[model samples]
Target: MKKTRIVILGAGYGGLMTVTRLQKQLNSDEAEIVIINKNEYHYETTWLHEASAGTLHHDRVRYDVTKVLNRNKVQFIQGEVLEVKAKENKVVLKDQEVSFDYLVIALGANAETFGIKGLDKYGYAITNVNAARRIREHIEYQFATYHTEEEKKDGRLTIVVAGAGFTGIEFLGELTNRIPELCKDYDIDQSKVRIVCVEASPAILPQFDRELVDYAVSLLESRGVEFHVGTAVQEAREDCVFIGKRGETPKELKANTLIWSAGVRGNAVIDNSGFENMRGRVKVNLDLRMPAFNNIFVIGDCSMIINEETNRPYPPTAQIAMQQGEVCARNIAKLIQGKTNLENFVFDDKGTVCSLGEDDAIGIVYGKKIKGTAASVMKKVVDDRALFMIGGTSLLLKKGKFNFF
Candidate 1:
């Protein structure tokens, strides 16, 4: 009898975790496991903001896939996924096709532009390693050319960030911290540079407690970050952004750099694969498997599950993604062993830490509120913990944030 072939897509948090666990659980003769990703290295999605702001090197956020996966048990294929022929049990890649007996879709997310005019053509998003690197380079180039350029355009130093959510706020925090260094390096006046955050919602950091939200806003304000709340960015142009307030005419703000961190949906491949999804996310069963297919599982940002207590979908995060991956691996192992019982995924609510640059942060962990240096320390601990979980102590030592004082 042929061995069961298991194919996992993408090397994000969920995909990498699943592959690592499965390799240890299943013997080489039991099943053949393969992981397909567009890039050979897996990047820490949560740390992309640091890369975008140039505060952290891009190399620090990424890891080689071969280093983590056991070559003897798992095969890693570096290729772009074009589409999934679900009905045929085949995945279409740019250059080839692969058939699988069991498939796991964890391709992750893409920025949702929300039909905003000119955004697709001009706006930059902190989506992946390459995109983050580009944003960092673009900002640096503008600063470097500020004096050399014949005309001094104040707009070149203005950065407009759309959305005030977690990703947006984190990025703004990094930018605020990096601006002073950049100004000194480029010999630009700090007063001339501006970092503005525009949010359509009535408030920013809606996910956090009201008190924490206020604290975050005040912290950002002290760092010279400006907030334009309850306003929507109607359009983005090459040299400026058009924003509108409630019952007001749209106004243009000149800015050479526009970063859109508003919202994210699942990868487009999920929709193109013909699976039933809401915003490209499949509402998976309790076991993390798609409703229509037993052999197919979905995790990370590409999968959605309603929270029983709140009656709302849980916000996709690296915390939940890693948990889901562990559950998926155990359940897959059960099926291979002819066991009937499958494990249900239960997310352990540890806490959330929102960093305000490298030194300050706010968080609610294990039901206790923390801020200032304490929260900042907790934030670094969280980062290191994630690295430790995925790649062990050695990997943590190499990529972990150790200075938590």
Candidate 2:
């Protein structure tokens, strides 16, 4: 009898979790497992903000995929994903093709510009490892150039961040701390450098409680970060951005560097693959499979799970992705073992912690609100826990953030 073949696309949090769990549970005779990713290494998507701000080295965020995956049961393929031919049950890669009996699409997301003009060409998004590295180098270059130029453009020292969501706020937290160090190195006055966060909403971190949001905003402000709470970025230009409230005339804010952390949509392959989706994300079934195709599972940012309480979509986070991966893996294994019933994916609301640089943070954990050093400590714990989840003790000890105040 031929063995069951399971292929997972994109070794992100979801895909890696599924691969990790399935390999340990399934025997050699039952099935064959293969995971395809564009890169050989899997990086922590959460730690990207720190790397982008030059506060954390890019090397710390990623590790070789082989280090965690079992080679005997799981075959690792490194190739770019072109598209998934859902009707044919095959994946088209840049250089090859793969057929699957069971498929998991965990291809992750792309930065969404929301129809803002010039954003594509002028702004930077902290999307991946290479993108984060480019941002760190780009900011460093701007500071160094400003120091050497006889005539310095004020815009060279100005950074306009388009959103104050989780990514934007965390980046600002690191950037605020990094600026002083950069100023000392570049011989530039700290007063001359400006870090501005513009949000269309009335408050920063709209999802967080007002108390937490206020504390974060106040703390960032104390560090000389400016907030345009109700301002929207009308357009992005090479040298500046036009910003204004709903009915007001947009004013140009001269800024050479613009980072857009406003939003992200699912991977482009989801659309190209002809999945029934909105903005590249499939509204996955309770079993975490695409309703239109029973054999295919979609997880992580590429899949959408709606919140019944709020009548809205749950925000895609690493926590939820990991949960989905584990559930999806169990279901796949059950089906392989000739079982009929499959488990549903459920997201347990643990809490949320947003870091303010390395030493400070805000969180709501298990119904208790925390801030300052306490929250910061929790943030590191959460990060370490994630490492422990996928790669076990060795990975945690190897890449865990141990520092706490």
Candidate 3:
């Protein structure tokens, strides 16, 4: 009999976790496992802000995939996935096509521009390792070029961040911390630099309680961060951004650097593959399988599940993706064993902790709200936990955040 071949796409949290669990449980006699990703390194999408702001080196946020993956149990392919032909059970890559008995799609998300004019050309988004590095270098370039200009434009020092959501708010936190270091290094007047955050929502971090939002706002404001809540980015021009109240005339905020952190949609491959998706995310069954296709499992930002309490879709998060991955591995194992041991994917709701730079944060755990240093510690612990979960103690000691002081 021919051996079953399982192909997993992308190496994000969900895909990696699924592979990690499956590798440990399965033997060569059962199935052959393959993981395809664009890069050999797996970077923490959650820590991109630090890299984008130059607070953390890009290397610190990513790791070589080979270190955690067992080559004997799993084959890792470094290739750009062009498309997935679900009907054919094949994934088309740039150089070759591979057929599989089962497919796991965890291709991740892309920056959502929301059809705003000029954003695609003018705005910067810290979506990946390269993007983060580019943003950091671009910001520094602007600071360095400021001194060389015969007529310095104040706008060069004005950095405007679009959105006050998770990515936006966290980026601002790191940027604020990074700005002082930049100003000194470049010999630029600290008072001349302006860091502004614009959000369309009524408040920043709307999911957080009002008290935490207020505290975060106040903390950032003291560090020279400006908040323009209840506003939207109308357009992004080459040297500035136009912002105003909804349905009103836009006013220009002259700034050379405009970073968009508003939202993200799932990988475009999802829609291209003919899966029924909203914003590139498929609404999956309780077992994390596409309704029409049981052999294909979707996870991470590419999969959607409803929150029974809210009667709406749960936000795509790393925490949720890893959980789905654990369940996904079990179901795949059951299939291999010729037993129906499929498990329903569940969001455990351990809690949430949002970092405010490296030293400050806010969180809710077990129904208890925390702030300041305590919250900061929790944030680091959460970040470290991800590394520990993937590669164990050695990897954790190598990449974990140990500065709790």
lDDT of 2 by residue, 1-405 (tens): 888899999888999999999999999788999999999999999999999999999999999988889899999999999899988989999999999999999999999889998999989999999999999998998899996764537689999988999999999999999999999999999999998899998878877899998999999999999999899999988888999999999999989899999889999999888888988899999999999999999999999999989989999899899999999999999999999799998789899999999899999998889999999999999999998999999999899999332
Q: Candidate 1 on 303-353: residue-level lDDT in tens?
A: 999999999999889999999989999999889888979999998989999
Clashes of 3: 0
Highest lDDT model number: 2
lDDT of each: 0.92, 0.93, 0.91
In order of lDDT, best first, we have: 2, 1, 3
Better of 1 and 2 by lDDT: 2
Candidate 3 collision pairs: none
Task: Please provide, for model 3 over 136-204, each residue's C-alpha lDDT reduced to its tens digit, 9 standing for 90 to 100.
Answer: 998998899888974537678999998898889899889999999999999989999999898898878
lDDT of 1 at 247: 84
What's the CA RMSD for each of the models? 1.5, 1.5, 1.4
Judge candidate 1 at residue 128 and give its lDDT: 98
Point out the higher-scoring one by lDDT: 1 or 3. Answer: 1
